[model samples]
Target: MAATLRDVTTYDLKLAAPLAAGFVLFFVTPLVILLALSFQTDPQGGHYGLTQYVNFLGDSFSLGVLGSTLWLGVKVTVLTLLLGYPVAWLHQRSPGWARGLIMLLVLLPLLTSVVVRTFAWVVILGRQGIVNATLSWIGLIDTPLKLLYTEGGVVVALAQVQMPLMVLPIITALSRIDPNFADASSVLGAGHWRTFRKVILPLSLPGIVAGCLLTYAAAITAFITQSLIGGGQMLFMPMYIYQQASTLQNWPFAAAISIVFLVSVLVVVSIFNALGRLSRGYANA
Candidate 1:
């Protein structure tokens, strides 16, 4: 028994050491670098101090950007869930060749570059673009409305781009639910809505929470789509950070903002995870 235990311990160390090193390199390395840079001086010699954080936290403009970014995140998350749930249900219900085709269509965006996707939105949402042209043709509006470069445009663009990320996980989760459970509930005289409410929804909560978390985090830090679609008017935290770091040459402050965004995402995900745990316990009970 001692010999067997010794071999198992040796095998575990062999498996864990490389994984631990890779984890540190992949996750810890950048965090260490960012923390160091956040305390370093920039070209303006603002000095190594909490001034960067203070400037980020104290400025109303920055606060407004943070608020807008948070709101945008929430909107995108909700919209994704709204669309993703139905699509996931469809995939599960069909789970056939049609489902594969539908999934392929849903995930096709993943194969394309984000820049290309954003540019596509620019074309579609432009003043003389497909959407406005269609509206004008139908006499819905006499003139091309200002659709591009607005909050609405940003929301739509973000939703379209982050959709696949939301749908895939949900469909995966939904497909795993045993249909027999639903069948049994229905045969027991539980109506469709009741079965869905009591069984299907509760089972899928993990996936829904996961999808929401992914969409929210991606929406908050999204730079390319936000920058292009927002038309330099909207100020998301990620774009603001880019402007500060590259355009304004304020590395320290940029680093601080980056750290702030990172912390915010971590906190949000942590809260969701805690809620997820409590929800699982409650549902199981």
Candidate 2:
């Protein structure tokens, strides 16, 4: 028994050593490098200050990037919820092949590459694209409406891309809810709207919270979709960071920008998680 226990311990240590090393190499080492570079000066390679951070905060360009990214994230989250709830509910209530079809449609984007998906949006939203041409033919406008290169374009693209993330969680949550609760509410003379507002929404808050967090996080860092659809005019933080690190060759400033974005994303997500928990508690009570 002692020898068996010793062998198990030895094997565990042997497995953990490589994993620990890989963790350091893959995650920790890069984070440490970013932290170090975030403080270190560039060109002069002098001792560091908060100059990069201050510059990022003070620069109107960088500030605009942050604002746009956050605003787009909010828009995407809200729009996704509006569209996703119905789809999720349908999926939950669906029978037989209908449920399978709905789920397949919801998850179709997951199998496709981001670049390919964005390109497809580009075609659909282009001036001579299907949407514009259809609208023009229907006498909506004499000209092809400018869909690309605007915030609206970015939101539309993002919502489509992130819809699956929203739908899946909400459906899962909705599925766990007992249909008999709605039946009971009806038996008690509650209408559909009241039952949904009081019962269904409360129970599904967890899934809503999870989906919103996932959508918001993805939107905040969205790059290719924003770039292709926004025509480089949308300048979100990720794009700004990309330019600073790759184009400008300012590693320290890039690192600082990355850290700032990381903190901002974490703060927003924490707030969302907290609200979700509080709402869930209130619902239970």
Candidate 3:
């Protein structure tokens, strides 16, 4: 006799217990300890107060570092979206064989270490690098431009490094869109730009939001790329926290800074979540 069956994974809460326990033990427990430590006035960990937090928030330099890091994320996210959208759209529009080649190129960056990728940017942006050489060949300037160790350099490098994060989601979203919708818009006498602005863009809002969130988070916290491209002079939150914890040995202040950064990131994530909800409605309309 044949037996009837159904998917058990959908309803099996018990299957997730071990994962939940692991998360609690590894993540939640450490986060709680860190939060508690952030309240301590002493690095030694017993004297509890808001001194560390007050020091951070009340200081202008510290606030500037936080603001600059967030701004850096925004710049990187915007550049990535602008560059990635075209690549994704191209991938979507390409023929079957071309799609495979485009996808390979997109996935190629992920195969290597981030450090390696970042160092490649370092070479490319250096005084005698390809950019300067190209500019010289074109007579754009008599001298090599200072590209490395600048904010612009950091933004460009981060965008290249984090591009796939922005592109892949957009490709997925674009693929889901019905081709007939575009054709219908054209039939309704909408020009290409009008169809894209009205139909394609609205439908792709969810993917754009997802891509932006991922790119923003990665770009801001990219310690390796930031350190290599931005140099010691450009101080962001990751470097600030590292200096406090490792160099100065001020664990309490580091913990406090970390908590504040975490809260700020959570706020950004909440905004993205709200955008995602709005995008769904916008897409429907």
What tens-digit string does per-residue lDDT give for candidate 3 at 1-285? 578687775787897999999999999999999998899998887789999999999999999999999999999999999999999999999999999999999999999999999999999999999999999999998999999999999999999999999999999999999999999999999999999999999999999999999999999999999999999999999999999999999999999999999999999999999999999999988
In candidate 2, what are the lDDT values of residues 68-152, reduced to their tens digit?
Answer: 7888899999999999999999998889799999999999999999898998999999899989999989999898888988889
Q: Candidate 3: where are CA atoms >4 Å away?
A: 1-10
| Best first by TM-score, ranked | 3, 2, 1
Instruction: Residues 33-66, candidate 1: write the lDDT tens digits.
Output: 8887887656565467777788888989888888
User: Which residue segments of model 1 deviate by more than 4 Å?
Assistant: 1-13, 41-47
- Top model number, TM-score: 3
lDDT of each structure? 0.86, 0.89, 0.96
Task: Itemize residue pairs with steric clashes in candidate 3.
Answer: none
Worst 10 residues of 2 by lDDT: 1-10
TM-score to native of every candidate shown: 0.91, 0.91, 0.96
How many backbone clashes does every candidate have? Answer: 0, 0, 0
Give the C-alpha lDDT of model 3.
Answer: 0.96
Which pairs clash in the backbone of model 1? Answer: none
